[model samples]
Target: MRADARKNREHLLAVAGAAIGEQGVDVSLRDIARRADVGLATLLRHFPTREALLDALLRTSFDGMAVRAAGLEASGEPGEALVSWLRDCVVWTTEYRGVTVLMAAAIEDPGSALHASCVTLRAAGARLLVRAQAAGVARGDIDGADLFALVAALAWLGDQPSLAPRADRLFGVVASAILTGAGGGDVEGAPPSGRG
Candidate 1:
């Protein structure tokens, strides 16, 4: 593709990504083309089908998460990095609510790009989970599959804006309790104050 054509394609992907990632898979490509200031033909040339476009959008999000996870694995302490990764996952799910639905659909329908992304995500998440377990900072029995399910549940909070922030807080509280093997922050029901 020519330089200008490639630029237009990239622009279209960005616009389509935000729209579909937010609105859902049902978003119209014509609107995406208009948002990107490109013609219909150019959009179709880049993504032949609506499924292909949704797959690309999901792949883009997954690829970004993979990169961030890789970076966390590289430089951060194992337990700390795992916590950071969990926090980031909640934030990402909140931003792209449609992703949870897309992931579920992909799991039922094989040969999907979203399925490939899920595989990669599982591998990456497993690595971090193993590291956290080794450090005795996470549940040893927590598998990657379970974590994926939790993330999907977390995404459901996005449907209700009033609950999203509270959900993140509750997730953090529960995750910390699981990591520390504590219950409701002791009998007094107050979180222990520390430099953790």
Candidate 2:
């Protein structure tokens, strides 16, 4: 692709990602094209199908989280690293609200390009979860699957028609539950003990 064409493709992906994620998959391709100041043909060339576009958008977001997670490894304590990465994930999810729905749909149909990336994301998440458990910051009983579910739920929350004022509070609840110590006997939906 020409430099300009590449730029257009990236722009369309970014705009469509935010718009569809904030709105719904029902958002028109024409609208995305208009917002990107590109012709519909250009958009189609980059993202032949709506599913393809969504998958690309999701891949882009996951790639970002992966980079952030790697950086957090050396940032501070392991538990703190997990908290930082989770906050970053929440911000990404909120930016792309309907992403969880896309994820589910992709899972239901593995032929979709999004499925592989989703699986990769799951593996990456598991690594973070395990690291926290090893650090003794999180309860050992917290399963990796449950942590992934929490992330999907958070993405669903981000997809809301409007941003909830309690976005931070919700994140806090999630972080606290995952950050409890073994002796604390699992926070499990409880608020932070106000000690850490």
Candidate 3:
């Protein structure tokens, strides 16, 4: 890329990151272009679609999440590392409004630009999970896919206006169940039943 073009792309990415972080993924592309002092045509030339823009914007964040997961695993107890990482995943996924939904779709769609990044992030979580389960802290049956789904679900729930207030509590309950084996059976599906 030419120096001027690269500069424009970087500026656009920075402005878009801040706008989406504050307002959401739904923030207008025109608004982003205006904020970056670039024309709509320039923005379109740089990012042909909303998904492309978002994929570029979030790539660094996803890489950071993977790095953090590795650091957590190295420093903390296996189970605690997994739990702590999951909490961070929730925060990371919801940093931009609608990011969690985008991530979920990206993970399922092989053609999505974000799919590779999402897979790397999930693999990071899976590494911690494998360690936890081997240490006899996490449930044996659950896998990386399960952990990824749980993190995405928590992030989605955390983003909802009605559920935001209770999201922390929900995380606690779910984390406890995953860590302590208090609730028997699959952690990925339904909540455990109350004893009579």
What does the lDDT read for residue 151 in candidate 3?
87
Question: Which candidate leads in lDDT?
Answer: 3
In candidate 2 the C-alpha lDDT for residue 28 amounts to 90
TM-score of each: 0.80, 0.79, 0.87
- Per residue, candidate 1 scores C-alpha lDDT tens digits across 1-196 of 8998777767877898778656766788898888888788889989988878777766776888888888888877676676667666656665654667777667656787678888777667667778778777677778877777666765666446676545645666656654644212321222221111
What C-alpha lDDT values do all the predictions have? 0.68, 0.69, 0.83
Per TM-score, the best of the predicted structures is: 3
Displacement of the residue 28 alpha carbon in candidate 1, Å:
2.0
> Which candidate, 1 or 2, has the higher TM-score?
1
- Please give the lDDT score at residue 182 for candidate 3: 32
Q: Give the TM-score of candidate 3.
A: 0.87
What residue pairs clash in candidate 1, if any at all?
Answer: none
Pairwise TM-score winner, candidates 2 and 3: 3
For model 3, state the Cα shift of residue 165 in Å: 1.0
Q: How many steric overlaps are in each model, in order?
A: 0, 1, 0
lDDT of 2 by residue, 1-196 (tens): 7998788778888899767755667799999989888899988989998888887777877787777777776566777777677666656665554566777666556798888877766666667778888878876887656766777676565555354544556767767777876423322332221111
